[model samples]
Target: MSFSRRAISLCAAVTLSYGVISPAIAQAQDFNGIVDSVHTHAADDASAKMAPLGSYASGQLAESAAEIVAFHAGSKRILTVNALSGEIDVLDASNPQKPTKIGSVSAGADKEINSVTVREDGLAVAAVQQSNKVLQGEALFFDAAADDLGAAELGRVTIGALPDNVHITDDGAYALVANEGEPSNELDAAGTAYVADPAGSVSVITLPAPGTVEAATQADVRTAGFEAFDAPGALHEDIRIFGPVNHHNKPSLDLEPEYVASAKGKAFVTLQENNAIAIIDIASARVEKVVPAHIADHLQVPIDSSNKDDKAELRTIPVKGLSMPDSIHAFTSGGKTYFATANEGDAREWGVEEKDGGSGVYTDEVELADVIDNGQVCEGVLDDVEAEALGDKKVAGNLKLSNVSGWDEEKQCFDELYAYGSRSFSIYDEAGNVVFDSGSDFEEITASLNQPGVFHHNADNEDPDFDDRSDNKGPEPEALTIGHIGERTYAFIGAERVGGIFVYDVTDPANAKYQTYINNRDFTVDFDEDNYDSTKLAGDLGPEGLAFIDKQDSPNGEYLLVVGNEVSGTTTIYEVESVVEKEPSTSGSTKGSSNLSRSSLSSR
Candidate 1:
């Protein structure tokens, strides 16, 4: 549905990029059941200003920042894994805004550490992929005080192809690792499928009691429920297949475990490509169930599918897409376990090269003609002559959906398959049932406040590619972490493309309330269209990992939010406070009742 300007002005509280709207505007706005007034919790102390009190520098060109974890050792410090340099840099963050580099540790020469988890006692586990080859990764442990490479090593356990994520249980008894055995981009001689089997699994690290940290053993849980969950396509016709020629491979062989979270003796692992979540019993090191998180039907769900490069306008299109979650984190509230994911969708490619001589958009124009035409529900997009002209245009290989029904002549909808990600954050119950989804909240909120010429701009660069990211993943909510302050629970979702943190009150997982949005990137400067310098861009860019330190654990006794920006190679920090004076958005009387639509809650 096209949002009228009057509706937008009426429903949205006018907000500037770096400033809050007037009290009258905040009071006038009514977002149906959504939060109306949003506020920023900047640091109260003069020493720390807004977000990014301080930033730790990493690599310049290639994305060096990956994951980060904060723990109080001696004083509060932050540990960040630089994927480009393969170094674990330690920073002194006792002061939130003015963090200084204290020490550094290396994973190896060229190895990339995907993730790190630190316990209260300073025992940390890092998932390191030694080689690009499948199954060459390992789980490495380090004592809290150990600094140098050799001195930090406590023990090492061999894992699978690619250890994508690692998390230590709350009690520190076990550490779970998601080994994403992703297939190589190299295709077979026939150019039909991947060369290596993309079988992914989880590894459990048995940690000794409180004192004996050196005695640790790793268990590979790949074979658990291998037959049931990862059966061949013949056994389950609905199984997702990337390409047609991979019929010889089984689903178990291609289920790449993307991220993992552990709570109450169980680990929740997300299989991004397979669109499933594997619940693992940590004690037995077995998979209980591989629940399929199905496709998001566009018909019921309202999504913004218009090209992001267009001038700052949001068009909520009804198009189906796969909800391939990238980063998953778990939390608990009111005796029930809940988890949230940054649905920054992803896909794989290998068979062919792009005609444009670039890394992205590997499919040639001719191959995408049918899908793009099918992508549109209306008529006349693809005539006999237009089909011949499409050979000159290029599109991404996976953008087109394979199973979309031919265009509906009357309704004028192709039922075209959208991209992979839900482009928002989702909350799931313990049984993997959908509780709440942020829906077009990210798109709507961002579009309402973003400055002109910067909509859907990638956070990584100074050149604002206005509306460039809208076609793919809008905002691309990549990093998610939840923290509790007083009786309220806030979920912070980092938008990788636009460079901001979306705050939502998920205290009630069933009906989460949007709290506020905060971004520290520098937005005052204009884009230097000629020679682009990413560092000069406003605000931090490419937020890859987020660490939410509670008020109690925080060094300054304030709620601390740490974000690692991958493109700019820096770890930015924020001090936030929750000011709850108004009633919850879900409880009060609302305007625009029709606007309160259930987010693509589940694939029907």
Candidate 2:
């Protein structure tokens, strides 16, 4: 099933003439029938100008300096979140080939910055979590155009706890913050119970009008709380509410806002752990509704559910995947708004680890084999024929599932199995109805490439072992951004684990076509987590955030995509080229042939 690199390159070159086709045309031609007109370009086709800023503390997790990133067009500066140092690293991005670190902005020694956003006029706002994350956080504003970036603090306004992400309105009139409200892992003083969890909420900050010097203050800040959903029957049963019972027993505390996307006067916040989206009325500072995300059915679309198969093996299984999206973006087309999400799944695992002298009481993850051995699975639920198919280690036995769901209370056992993430991206309407989902395409596309020795399919960020992450979220698509180029709109999605950026043409939200996949890492390098070296041959790893710079705003005057790689502690700038469609020839050959060879879509 593996193809030579030369053969993949040849396939990519020949497919360049056939631009993306609409879903209707693809269906009419009886195409492979996944997404329409999928294509994967050669590595040389999408080369990037990367700036590898070394890690904060080598060989340590969560110590890498770079995470989320923001670009200020006015100043041509790239502001990146250095969580380890709790500061924003400002880089002069005027030269895309060689970006230099100029200065940094910090609220204080005790503040930890989570997210940042910049306006056209050089106004930068950062979401700062307090030293004690349970306490109220703050939104600190700065004038990035100032001569001294570090000393250009404009002002600060108090917000909710653990403000994880911030986004500015298109008109620059407001700043919306998604306060995650994560609880501390430590137990109560008595060491026998959990403490009260902080309620998750969103804060809307009304920025000063255009050409005004006035700064935003506490009076301009309004909080949107989730208390309205605390009542019984307020939340959908599908929306997860499972956390430490003592602390997160209520929907108000269980729902943690992860990211924010806005359109018109409303904001859509992703509650990752809850597997839902919270709609907020910005002007009124109220949560209108919480809509549960769609569960991915693997029975219709296959997935690689095993790491022990020794190669990329996709198969259908009796399991459902939760679309716990981590990042979301909103765009309007045909007078209607659509939200695109990277369905990177998540689980609720809190409290100190057993290795750190505390019980793992809040973890909800379990393996299928362990669930069966512990007698938690319902008897007679799986017939002998069905059990035999999923009983081996190379099958569904080692697959990870959530222990908090699918419980049959009356029977005291589980009736179904649930996995973490959908391993794809989806488009949803304003009402949260799924318009289109890239079902099994991520894994299928990656597996089809099969680049030997380098860029293994479904490999982990720290290691190049192929199919290593099949048992978990395969090719986890966590970072996402949407941009409009010419008459078409494209969505740039980053796979955090497999280390690449996937481009999709989403002009027609319901008929998104895959454009290309690009990964810069050289897998031959020896990447040992215990003795890591950022300056080695390692490329960008763990893409956590993506910012699209239009041709007009781009420093180099070309469409640019800025990525923040958290694991390798690097920020890369990729030049994006629009795909030009060619008219079909008048020859007797079929124009949109479904019988096109699969090698034409293979990537290297």
Model-by-model lDDT, in order?
A: 0.61, 0.75
Error of 1 at 448 (Å): 0.2
Q: After the best TM-score superposition of candidate 2, give how far the Cα of residue 60 lies from its true spot, in angstroms.
A: 9.2
Clashing pairs in 2: none
Kindly list the per-residue Cα lDDT of model 1 for residues 534-597, writing each as its tens digit: 3334435667888888877887787788888775566877666655433334552111212322
Find the candidate with the highest TM-score and give its number.
2
Structural RMSD, model 1? 8.5
Show where candidate 1 strays beyond 4 Å: 1-51, 72-75, 147-150, 218-225, 232-239, 351-416, 453-462, 523-537, 581-604
TM per prediction: 0.80, 0.86
Q: Model 2, poorest ten-residue lDDT window? A: 1-10
